[model samples]
Target: MPSRSFVVLAEQAQARHDGRVQFRQVLIDAVKPAVDLVYPPRCPLCGTAIAQQKGLCAPCWSELIIPGEPCCTTCQRPFPADYSEAAMVCGPCMADPPRHDGIAAGTLYNHASRALVLSFKHGRRIALSRMLAPLIIAQLPQLEGEWLVVPVPLHWSRLWYRGFNQAALLAEHIAKATGQTLLVDGLRRTRRTQPLGGLGRKGRERMLSGSIRLHPRKSDVMKAAQVILVDDVLTSGATSDACVKALKRGGAKTVKIACFSRVLDEARGQNTAMPETKTPEA
Candidate 1:
């Protein structure tokens, strides 16, 4: 059991965090008009000017595949309109059940979404976090129990090189929007692993094995709690699975994955050619 002092201290920390977030929002709101005027909004993909900031043009918007219902019950991979079943589990889920509760993906991996991800992540367009976070939030279900938002951790080397973890940015926005507790350091990457690009599911799993674990101080906070593991992209599911395993190992009751995009090669079938990992953003 946690002590009263611990609870109070936690509350204070959360209050401070909320205050900082609100301050940033206020600051952005204040200067956004001027910024918009200086650099008019344009479609992230095609560079076509748009009316609103952080929005897509009509053609680019059409290219994005926002996932909806008739999805796999276990994984939430969208199913075809004519696809129907009593269990509602996709073929992949049926063959090998997922360890996590389900996935909440904003869009299927497509050219338009790929460009946005590359721009936001690799191109250092941090402002795009605002645009991407909402897509992921729209896919999330209403919460019924206590839920903690946690980002998939990055190793020290990666953090130092990248300056910021893209997943953490998304997770922070999600926690703020959903009114959930954001445990920014809930999980920690134990060591640096090679990128998962060009790797098969088994190969990726092998690389991520024992690479992620719950933060020592976060065990109590995670115990019996429902956790939302956030990431920018869900490719092979290897990374998210490792994070979920760590959360459950730390006594979390349930873990769900929320991501900006998901690569559904199985759902899309052999006809659709997809990139192996797509910038190692998984």
Candidate 2:
């Protein structure tokens, strides 16, 4: 019914409307609410809906104690308020120094931190590693000369049942982030020990003692190599100490630990870190 000229004008108006607005961007923005409705990013620590993935909401972050400066020179534990600023080994560590040269953890293990660690360690939430690896790496000082990133090894039998090693996953992400060479198999668990959860320090140590060793064929390469041990949690330092002992016995020059969380007997109310020589960072 319209004249050709009128028809042309109508088409032009439609084109102008389409061009004036970015339908792609508009559509993307419009669907975001729907998209968010279907899939929202939740905090890794708690299920609270957060703005982004791998987020620890403000409350959770505040509740969890992050390790910072003036840590122990040996064990890297935070000092009690009265003893802050003095860098010395806690009595517990001084009683018998850990075999590893040094140790550090991203956060003190507590009720607030336990949930996050358990969820990742047992809940099969591999995605949480993205958030956790950074925390572990943050505590590590740069090591001397081309250190090898070694994840605490899991016995093959346990690995078969679990389908994955949490420590190896952390080591993988850490190796990528730091561009360090990783030897996931540099150390192998000689035998499976009982889970360390219900064990005291001595029990744990006894269980893990003589349980780790370097790969027989890889021994030549690892000899004299500095080692960076990776693990999910540091409880009594027994397993780490055992690992360090094995490595040193196998000819590793030095070994240090970088773990995501630590379970210390803070109720004792004493200094927590240990004394050790500072390694020059490369």
Candidate 3:
């Protein structure tokens, strides 16, 4: 017969093994429904049901106004019909050059695209990134050299409030699709600045200046590789410019900006030109 101590040890070991088995079973059961649901998913923009996984229905996908020919290479702005160059730089870019080498965006941030961006940023519709990633990947041929993917960092306070960084999520998806390395911690917003929305161009630039800091450990990676800054939206470009400046200062060989949407110049009407009246400070 076994001694008392030996019996206790055996019982404890058996209990641990049983617990592990039960935990694994629970995990399997929990994940099965999620996998099934993803196969026939709902559209992130319109909430319409989709038959395929990780995509909008065919009609909604077709309706998206993807950026086409005659766009500014630096800013990705649509140019007038008279402009015929494949790499047309916008007037602002020509006048005041950005630190980054180039900009690539998936779509114009018009009413249709805004719906998807708002859902992802405000409504926590993270699944929308699946649809957007491929669009970003299509622009990868335009990128050159050994590139690292860096998402625009959210201030820690805002990150805590939202429980997630939408840009990071989008960057992760893009990284996965393109097989590019993602350096999420390369840049961080050390001091929370005023909201860029509603601010005039100068105010927006001022708010972003000196707001971002590059991570110390990522210095080596930044030095060795080109970088692609990722974000969900591009409004005045001030925020991205700040990130680009920080990355370059940290020794990034080159930097480019990519986003799901870019705000059109014409869309910045008089009513929306004013910055928000007030925002919480960090």
lDDT of each: 0.88, 0.78, 0.77
| Clash count, candidate 2 | 3
Cα lDDT tens digits for candidate 3, 41-65:
6766566876644677777787777
Report the CA-based lDDT of candidate 2 relative to the real structure: 0.78
Task: Identify the runs in model 3 with alpha carbons over 4 angstroms from their true place.
Answer: 1-40, 270-282
Q: What is the lDDT of residue 182 in candidate 2?
A: 89
Q: Could you tell me every candidate's TM-score relative to the true structure?
A: 0.85, 0.79, 0.78
- For the record, the alpha-carbon RMSD of candidate 3 to the native fold, in angstroms, is 8.8
Residue 265 Cα positional deviation in candidate 3, in Å, after optimal superposition: 2.0
lDDT, ranked from best to worst: 1, 2, 3
> Which wins on lDDT, candidate 1 or candidate 3?
1
lDDT of 1 by residue, 1-282 (tens): 999999999999999999999999999999999988999988888999998887789998899999987888888878788986755988788899888998899998877777888888888888899989999999998888679999999998888887898999999999999999999999999988987776778998999999999999988888899999999889889999999999999999999999999988664454333443444444
Query: What tens-digit string does per-residue lDDT give for candidate 2 at 1-282?
Result: 889999999999999888767777788788887877888878777679898655688898898788876667888777765676565777767987778888768888766667776777667788888888998888888765788899999889878776788899999998889888989998899898766655567887788888898888778877898888999888777788888888888899889898888877663243332211110110
Deviation of model 3 at 80, angstroms: 3.4
